[model samples]
Target chain A: GIQVEQSPPDLILQEGANSTLRCNFSDSVNNLQWFHQNPWGQLINLFYIPSGTKQNGRLSATTVATERYSLLYISSSQTTDSGVYFCAALEGSNYKLTFGKGTLLTVNP
Target chain B: SAVISQKPSRDICQRGTSLTIQCQVDSQVTMMFWYRQQPGQSLTLIATANQGSEATYESGFVIDKFPISRPNLTFSTLTVSNMSPEDSSIYLCSVRTGRGNTIYFGEGSWLTVV
Candidate 1:
């Protein structure tokens, strides 16, 4: 029902660099999450932020529900951070996540 | 937080044969979700399984291709029927504790069809 779009389809960063990823949804959402898909293909939840800002180590996320968009920030990136970062949302109570295409980040050492 | 275990962490299947993937949750949950992640892609919602009720699948996915069964609150199974190379991807199961958004996933089942 809702559409999710992610910006910067691909990114290349040097070790210790910083970058920002954005996700914009077409409809209102109550549950929004940032996930990191590692090389092994495990979807690791980074933050469950429907609104406001949250920081976890070097990764941080901010969601502006009113604007229907969210931003993910990765500071001082490491090679281990190389993978695809995805943003998903829950439009209704069912809470089933509708995911964005994702932002692929490659950090070269 | 919930700990999830998926049977046969990885498998190799021959085309035209079907395979079942099992998802087990340590604690009972009201909502269980099935997802597929293709190579170099993001997660795609396959369906949402609720205990004692039928699963609601996404638009492109069909019941005939991916049949899901949630007989109980803590267990569910997804069967890929008449598998092909296109079905070769990573299938994952996740659960929500009912607070709404916090969804956790298992390690995932890697399927390779030859």
Candidate 2:
């Protein structure tokens, strides 16, 4: 099984601020995904980046697969973005995903 | 992308009881997964359900406790049998579609044992 690590266990930002979250994996992965768990406990899919970069609205993500790391960028953060952000990866032929502990983000008005 | 729907979004049960959670996917898939998210903890993979085959359980989970059924390519069911207080957690069903291998999740079934 592969290991996933997320940095900045906690974060607080004012509305309209920007922040970056990083995820590092112990081994190469064939699939990588980012999710935001909202206050109501909904796991919202943010990105499915195995390599290169992708942007969705005010959020963006980059995965450097060769280096076994990924970065998620949140620009103009809103209070609605307050939740736990998680990164998960699946390596090789494994169907199971290894998840990071998640970074708790709180955006205040 | 795939649309996943789960039944009984939340429930409360007594110890030693059993509950079955159903997962329905809009499109056919080869693999379906069940994950558990304990309170204040990260998500952990419970088992992988493949069509026409028995599920592969994780290290801490077993077939007797969390029996899973994959009767078809588009549907699966996970039953928490003889559960206890420690079994209370949010159980989610997920799958990887053909579109770039993007994994999608259901809303999850939140269970509480008293």
Best model per lDDT: 2
**TM-score of chain B, per candidate?**
0.96, 0.97
Model 2 interface CAPRI class: medium
Docking class of 1: medium
Where is model 1 more than 4 Å wrong at Cα? none
Q: Which structure among the candidates has the greatest DockQ?
A: 2
**TM-score, cand. 1 vs. native:** 0.95
Query: Candidate 2, clashing residue pairs?
Result: none
- What lDDT is reached at residue B15 by model 2? 96
TM-score of chain A of each: 0.98, 0.98
Runs in model 2 deviating more than 4 A are none
